[model samples]
Target: MTTSLMHTSQQNQPLISWRWLSLALLVLCIIAFASASTSWLRISPDRQLQISQLQYFLNVGISYCSWLVIAVFANWMRLRIPLFSEKHPKWLLIHCSVAALISLLHILFDTFMLGLLFSFDFNFVSAFAKKVAFWLPVEMVAYLACVVSLSLLEQHKKNLKLPESEQSYTFEQGNQVRVVDRQDIEYIEAYDNYVFVHCANERLMLKQSLSSLAAKLPDEFCRVHRSYLVNLMAVECFESHSDGQAFSRLKSGKCVPVSRRRKMAVKSSLAALHTHIH
Candidate 1:
């Protein structure tokens, strides 16, 4: 290839990267810092400012930081698990457990720890958890929805079915084989340890774990279940099973089951995209 062509190919390589998450979190941190220092939120329950103002902002800032840390950690953990872009059972378990643990810690710190240390009666722990619970899941769900929607769009593009809004990992050794998307992707099927990516237009076999490929996939493909990652844009119809199994029927005429747990999420993602259209 000519230098210009080679440069263009390099530039056209997928722009999917998570380094932006850090930048986003930093911006949020700055916002929290600024918001905390402002006089908007009062120091105490009372409107009259009787006590010194230092404590209020300090507590708010601390709470914001704590929540931000929890969020970042949760996303990192979710991304770390190799589940082929699907939500892993262990991921959910860990998320709930860690979130609970953090809740307890936040409670202890804000309630007994802070109150006892400062001689204040505020049950900050309970208050903090309550507020955090209210907001955290919503944010997480929104991000997940975005990722799913984008993945679906990518799948559609691959099949030449639709033009989409194109807003779109490391390893070791031969065991950590890097996928050359052009040569290796005929179709992808998700099982437990591996998502079989058929190359050579379905005559060749290259098996890689779903989690690994998911990390490499552009936004147009998504894990619809533990066992299936389908291109949502290529999805022709979604079917319901009499046995309570939900499945997405793809343009390839392939029917893949959507796990019970992921059904709601898949539907929610589709709904979001539909809303975005109008």
Candidate 2:
């Protein structure tokens, strides 16, 4: 009953909703412009000061828009987080580095335009300095706002429906199926007086017993605990304890306790299998 409830909840979650996010982003952009304009209008004195204010606002708007574009690309590409293990770190680093390079170039171009507007000759160093001067605070706030908004947007989408790329796997109450891809599995844990099948790629709940699942699993999997069965291909490491108990750590870094009864037999089976493969 609980497994069925969990499966239903997972099936209902969505990945993203662009329409709502677009509306929210539009509102934020309006608020930013309004706030900046209100401040500039209060500080300006003469006609020239008003012109300066216009230049400042225009420069800010352009910079913010460019950052928004970059943020969209980053979100679309699904850039990796520092500690996020689901995506590759190298790919994320490359994407962020390229975005940073483009943003820098954008600032340089904006500074040149701003200097030209004020009748100042655009020197290489001055253009860089002016760019840095305007970009720091605006970009900082823009980045923070983008990150927060994106997080909320992601949650909103998750509440709606599943992501497009994650293919759904369904099983009937008594159906038998093969798990061909070892990478699809997260960990198999005992649940609700039955076994639960979990996968990292998508949210799926299967109703079956550990004994039944053991028979269906490939040779790479072994019953490590009475309540747990592990995929050997996904094993990250193993740790031995003083009490003659041990744990099998998975690539996901989840450690499952091994039973003392199955210890020797499991070890021997793994050794024999490893030898046979080589």
For each candidate in turn, the TM-score is 0.42, 0.37
Please write out the lDDT profile of model 1 over residues 1-278, one tens digit for every residue.
Answer: 00000100122234344456556656766775576456435556753342234345455655665566565555444434322324455644555555656555554554443453355555565666675676556544543444445445544544453222222111122434332333233345765544555333442223566655555554445577765566566666778778889987766676777888777666645543343444
In angstroms, the error of model 2 at 215 is 36
What ranges in model 1 sit over 4 Å off? 1-66, 69-112, 118-187, 191-194, 198-204, 241-243, 275-278
Query: What is the Å distance of residue 223 in model 1 from its true position?
Result: 0.6
lDDT (Cα, tens digit) per residue for candidate 2, span 1-278: 33432111133223455566656666766776776567656754575675566676666666656765666655544322321223344744555455566567778777666666666443667767766777654554554455556655544543553344233333443344333234466567777766676666644455667766565444456778878877676777767899787987778777878898777545644553444446
lDDT of 2: 0.58
lDDT, model 2, position 98: 50
Best by lDDT: 2
Query: lDDT of all the models against the reference?
Result: 0.50, 0.58
RMSD of each: 12.2, 16.1
- Best model per TM-score: 1
